[model samples]
Target: MQNSSPPKMNATEQAYHGIRNDILTGRLKEGERLTETRLSDDLGLSRTPIREAIGRLILEGFIERQSGYTTRVAHFPEDEAEQVYEIRRLVECYSVQRAARLATEEDIAALRRIHAAMQADTPPRDQAAYQRLTEANEEFHRTIVAAARSPRLTALMTTALDVSMVVRTYSMFSEKDLRRSLNHHAELIDAIEARAPDWAASVMSAHLLAGAARVAARLKTAGSDDGQD
Candidate 1:
């Protein structure tokens, strides 16, 4: 009998995903310095694969070049984060509207499953739990974008949604924020299932804006505290 299992990741894939996971799980953290030697040693791989992984991550906005042959995990400033969310709002709102009009039963079912997984992970107890929740959340949004059936928009979403800084923002959600977010997802599912484009768009706009507001408020508070210190 043939084995039924996923293929093992190659060295480069291992390095890439290992580093990315560390960043997303908050082990590496924003602005933390990184080096090829350190990563290669840590991953038990040669410099070649680690270097390639670092290059890909840098292009993907997970890592940033620093002064003279150094790099650090990318940090999104408040304005940059606001801009990213604004772009997401514009893109995702339109996508969800189209999805409402065009989504198939399979698409809706997939969304429901993702949403259920998200609900199950709610009030993420630890950093690892939060990481899983964040992944489910990402998949939920991506599934909606795919349901729009626009290849061009999906490609754009791939880039915008891949930002590590944005992924990390899920860890910022408070209990109230988490509940409100789940409610938004439920409303969105209803709107899509009802085939009401306007309703879906309205709910999505509210959802994205509410999240942006929460992040903005938190950033402002952090800046104030830093100033006081």
Candidate 2:
């Protein structure tokens, strides 16, 4: 049989994904300097690949350059986040509307499986468990996004979610809010199963806004303290 394994990532791909993952997961803090020399050493690649990766990151908004000079991880500005949320609201609502019409039994089952795995307790304050929680949360939403089956929409929303800072905000959700979010997930499944686009879109819209508000509040507080958000 011919080999079926996936192709190995090139050095530039490796460096790009490593740096991007750190930015998304908050391992690379906002405004932290991205020195090509350090990244080349850490990723065990040459400066050429690291430079390429940084360039990609700049184009994708994972990092930015000031006056096309110093490179650093991008901060999640409140205004920018709100603008992204508005775009997400439109994209995701349309997605759920489409998913409600299009999701197969297999798709519904897959979504349920992810939803069931989500933590019911207050998300752990620890780093590792929290990382898993973030992954699960992304999986839950991404499954639904995939169900919509629009490559263009998927790519657009993925960029927004990468910068949304949802994980940072979700970890700080009040117990009540966390429970409410989970309950909304369950109800969303019900709407999808019933193939009710209006119902599913409604739930998703409210769910997003609730989380956005919480994150905005956190950003406000952070601004008062150290401007981390």
Candidate 3:
């Protein structure tokens, strides 16, 4: 039998995951400056791997290359942030419908496992707990996209997903919002299992729209506060 273990990451991959985890956990805050030398020292890796990791991150929309050969954690303006969700709606809503029709038993099983993980006994009480939930949530969505069996759609969603990570959409959630989101995921699974494309698409549409509205409202509130300041 072939080895079932996952492959160990190489140095560059290590750097990439390290940096991405920091960004996702807010250890590397949005718009925070980065330099290869600093990151090399911080991650205890050499500059070559750090440079390679940064390049990949920039391509994946996790880091932005600014003027003067500098880079920072990616941050979007309000308009672009809104556009991110619009694009997600366009991409993911369709993907979910395709998944409903195309997903195999194994694919559906993976999604259910992710959903069950998210539906832990208690709510996320701290940053670490929330991080686990967020990662699980991301996995749930990515699995659906994978089940859609479209590489082009996956590529299209790459940047949108990264931007959503940067925005930390779940941070804006209330207890009620969290419950509603869990329900949406459950409904999505049911639709996909039933092979109901229309139902799956409808649930995905509502899910994405609700998330977009939350992000937009938060952005508006932040903008208002900034103006006052």
Candidate 4:
């Protein structure tokens, strides 16, 4: 049976997750300044946790601290984004292949729950619902990674799955693209259920490539807009 207990988290850990989610969902935004004082006020917490969280984000490549006095959300540049997708494709292809061999029935069910939430005619309609969908997407991929049972592979993927690239890529997904992505998740689960590692890896590769293309286009559009401005 799966452990039903929630993992314990300190204030700093909680603050880290909260701020990370905001960054991933575009609530924080790329290139937006992050002031400890403003974050403390917005999060209704002390500066200590907020400060700690920012420090961690910097190390994780989600935020950048300029010199010693400035901080901002990490921007998704085309060059860096290409590297992120390339690494994700390599790592996740291996991860999903292993998951096909290792994932339990319960793991499949957990993934299905996330997939169901992403289906057609049921797109997220509010801020909270959108947050749920975004987090569900993250969980679906993380579950596959965990099922791989490779700590090193998981660690590598974590770096590539940085918030800037993830949010910027997901932000450009149109409603049609969103539905197709959900379809891909369903197909991936089917591949895993069939214990076809190659099939599962192929699906994951296509998913990452599509996301990379979306993010690249978004960067190009943003660049054009900036030139106009």
Top of the candidates by TM-score: 1
Better of 1 and 2 by lDDT: 1
Candidate 1's displacement at residue 51, Å, is: 5.2
Looking at model 1, report the run of 10 residues with the lowest lDDT sum.
Answer: 162-171
- Per-prediction TM-score to the true structure, in the order listed: 0.80, 0.70, 0.74, 0.77
**Predictions ranked by lDDT, top down?**
1, 3, 4, 2
In Å, residue 38's CA in model 1 sits off its true spot by 5.9
Q: What's the lDDT for residue 81 in model 1? A: 78
Whole-model lDDT per candidate: 0.87, 0.80, 0.84, 0.84
Among all candidates shown, the one with the greatest lDDT: 1
What residue pairs clash in candidate 2, if any at all? none
**Per-model tally of clashing residue pairs:** 0, 0, 0, 0
Clashing pairs in 4: none
Better of 2 and 3 by lDDT: 3
Q: How would you encode candidate 2's per-residue C-alpha lDDT over 118-220 as one tens digit per residue?
A: 6532354565455566677778788888998889879987776763355545665776787778888898899999999999999999998988887788778
Model 2 residue 113 CA deviation (Å) reads: 1.3
**Tens digit of per-residue lDDT, candidate 1, span 18-118:** 89888866688678999889998888999999999999999878899988979999986899878888899999999999999999999999989988988
Candidate 3 — number of clashing residue pairs? 0
- Candidate 3: misplaced stretches above 4 Å? 1-62, 163-167
User: How far off is residue 108 in model 3, in Å?
Assistant: 1.4
TM-score quality measure for candidate 2: 0.70
TM-score of 4: 0.77
